[model samples]
Target: MNVAADPAPAARPLDISTFREGGSLNARLRQMHEGLLERVPAVDRIACALYDAGEDLLKTFIDSTRTGHSLEGHEFRLSQSRSLSRLATSGDVRILDDIPALVQHGEVHSDWLLEQGYQSSMTVPLFDNGALLGMTFFDARASHAFPPVAQRDLLLYANLINMSISSELAALRTVVASAQMAREFAHLRDFETGAHLERMARYARAIARAIAPRHALGDEFIEHVFLFAPLHDVGKIGIPDRILLKAGRLEPDERQVMQTHVELGLEIVERIIGDFGLRHLPDSSVLRNIVGGHHEKMNGTGYPKGLAGAAIPLEARIVSTADIFDALTTRRPYKQAWTTAEAVAEMRRMAVAGELDPECVEAVAAFAPRIEEIRARYPDED
Candidate 1:
């Protein structure tokens, strides 16, 4: 009998369940990445990129890396890449047993992966319902690390991650859709155009990016701020059409009624969270703060709560600044469209008058080039 009995693998003590944290998808991804490294030492990185169909683009969302740098700020259009487009179309798993074998393509993402010393990789297309949402990537330092059995393990993890992302986005869509329905039900004329929302989101992103470093904020924090910023005015659905639609300045009493929108927004947000069972949505306070506190001022003078200085959440402060900037620069029935320079001067004045956050105003000023680009991309309706 020449059959040599197989020796059992060494006993280990890595328990993934122990690292579980509630509520944050980003936090969960980090925990999963750490657990993956402990279970399979050769696997070195896990990352996700979210798709934006409106722009035909995919941007980095979250990642967990072991001895690898994050590709946090990377973005590319789906229309421009053959490989990613194929993945988007097929929604199949892609395996690269040897990453260096594909380096001849000269793609920026591949070049970066190669430079980072990853030798093998797997890419999974993520979806919510029938629509493509984004992609998840796993990279390894060792060639042929993701063989059949190992790939089965990786696939299970991929599905878990994709579900987390899908759940988060679906819950968010519910809130936004609810707000839209509320507006239509009340016959609230939708002055907040799709273009306005797009511009404001970008402005919020720029401000959040600038302030993040100084505040030790992660890309996920900036991501949440951008995600929730557009919903800041959802409460205006509760405002009366006369005050809301007035082509002239709001009268004193009308202004006071208009100020109630912030409170209304918070109520709508809370209702959506409760009714739809979205209480577990990650970073929900960010949503509440943006909607409930955006109108608060720095000098204890503004609306519903008069939250002065640091009492106002920084996310709200950022949104308010972005909102004001867009309102000033865009053409509205009640106000003339101010030039970029004129708007900047006015914002500076507002900051000095203690009506706006000075730091947020200054942060936005740092991105003058991007401001012009966003405006050009999302212009007002004729």
Candidate 2:
């Protein structure tokens, strides 16, 4: 009948500074596990079971203190133990001094308890707000009762752990959603140029990596360039079919209309930025800059904003070279595909004329063999 003693009033609130620092969820959970072990000295073994509400399964996720005993094949089924199931279903805490008695009374699994040599155990349900999340199990080998104070301290700790788990899940969901959107963006048929987008994106990453060290573009910059490259032609979604899908060379007026795709792409990207509220997100502005300025040329002849030199973002400059190289090297309805050698010669010509950034052109030339590999990797649409 003895219960664990209550913890001090000051210990009521669990310290959650580690969770706030922002890293992987599993790492944070492991830290919480270690913290609990350090705080509870008397407990010989601890096993945490998280109830996946969606799957309706109780899984042992964290285990820390088994020295002599092995729990390699132990199964703690929710349906097998009436007491544990009751605690989980009813959201209550049970502290037991006589573990064998509870099993004999049909509260827990008697055979399972004896096999593990568990004399005493504590089970506390984890919850956030009103919903049940999971439970924490604290066990000892000797027959010792939990004090009321200890029960209260364990409950508080369990609640803090549950809150941290929920927050981490939310962050993971955000990342997954962002990735799905990126995938959808990649598949859009706006460019209508048949794998031109994929080739150009690869080229963009290569150019960015080549120029990164010399231009002081850090790793973060290079990574963003790779991700944002696919969106270079995103504005083509807004261009009229007559301009976007044009098979023949465009007249002066038609060319002007086709040129509006860059502006359209910028506008579409800006709208996405506003909708996602990603303007303040780390490196988001850099991504947006790439989307908006990828078509700008080194010379003043580029469309939309007509940015020149360093006025164009570094990402955009890298993408511009990639986009043109892919365009020249790939077959279009209007022109036959150029050979790798021909593409390199054309790029060199542009570099010498200062129409394209010389560093990016050189990078493309250096990676010329890979360019053929890339073309083979993503074949043109027949």
TM-scores for all candidates: the values are 0.87, 0.53
Off by over 4 Å in 1: 1-21, 104-106
Pairs in clash, predicted candidate 1: none
Best by lDDT: 1
For model 2, residues 291-350, the per-residue Cα lDDT tens digits are 777767788677678888889887778888888888888776668999878887998898
User: Lowest-lDDT window of 10 residues in candidate 1?
Assistant: 11-20
Clashes of each: 0, 14
lDDT at residue 79 of model 2 (Cα atoms): 70
| Model 2 poorest 10 in a row by lDDT | 67-76
Deviation in Å, model 1, residue 93 alpha carbon: 2.8
